[model samples]
Target: MGICSIKQMTTRKLLVLSTIHQISVLLLSDALTVSETSPDAPNSDDTTSINHPRNLATEALYINQNFRRMVLKRNEEPFKYDNPRLPFDEGDTDADSCVAYKYRSWYLGRQADGTEVRLICRTEHDGVTTGPNGETQMLTIKAFNEWDSRMASGVDWRSKLDTQKGAVLATELQNNSCKLAKWTLQALLAGSDQIKF
Candidate 1:
């Protein structure tokens, strides 16, 4: 009777140990499977993973927002003239030949469908002048498609006049266009005040 009791106790211990071993094996296998299938897991065959479309779109949007902010900040600053004298300016051939000083500015705008757009304004002047100097300012306003990085289609306004009329028109267009663009960008970024009509 004593020998039988001892054998029974030994058998119970063996069973418990076996069960624990089996469970540990199962758990380790499951963990390995999960690690292998995870999205960030490294692949043995291919070193690089393809970028998901959603991720790409998100990255592009982030880039556009940053660009818009930079342009807006630059527009708020005052203009500076620091052009070095070029060899072409040294020749004295024509008296009426005016030195050209080019300036470019950008603004943010919104479309009818709640999409934000960027407007670039380029002006050329004969000398270092603030704002639009009469008879010497050539202005061109163009819309830029942020996503496409190309000039926005169906929106082009330009003026080339050497008179007070041109300056007035350019100033008016710049003020109106820049205001609209800046407002639109601000609204889009803040996700408030949707433009009506």
Candidate 2:
């Protein structure tokens, strides 16, 4: 859209468009921050703005899609719904033939400097979606937490030598005890396909 000024455009949409055009730009936002719609639309950058405290299932869905290369399915013309440019950026995930999932992972995190900053994040995807051929495709994502907080080998977490004989999951669980608890609680409340998880 040459009509829209760069300052007036949503960075998320701009990145998607840029990726399509093979342009280089830093992505400072989550991939699925919103419904891939218009910048001025009420829900343009909307993140699960409903009455819930938070939800992240949809972000997991996009991650799963990217991993599965289901994003390639978006190259199909019929799938090109929201983007003004196509043949490059993956198109919208159609809700008519599948579940239209939404997400919310807006939160506050402390930086290395101990300053709290807002960050967009990812979470979960609860159910299955149908493909164009009516094939049932299940989206299961395990965004596992590694124990290291971007820390060096010796400091924040125990050295590899120290934990060499311990169970890996146990060490991670110890370092991310509260994070694991929160993730478990979210998965339980979401009633997601644990078998899929």
- The candidate that wins on TM-score is 2
Q: How accurate is candidate 2 locally (lDDT)?
A: 0.41
Each model's lDDT comes to 0.38, 0.41
**Model 2: per-residue lDDT, tens digit, 1-197?**
36776666787688788786663223222222211121221221355543111223344335545553443345444332233232223565442333223344544788899987765433344345565788655443434322222331212334453566355444444544554565566655444444232
Q: Give the TM-score of candidate 1.
A: 0.17
lDDT of 1 by residue, 1-197 (tens): 45568788999899999999998767544321111222332223432322332333344435444443343333344333476333346565453322233444456677899887866443233222223434322222222212111112211233323345555444334434543465365444433322321
What are the runs in model 1 whose C-alpha is more than 4 Å off? 1-50, 74-197
Clashing pairs in 2: 56-124, 57-124
lDDT accuracy of residue 150 in candidate 2: 39
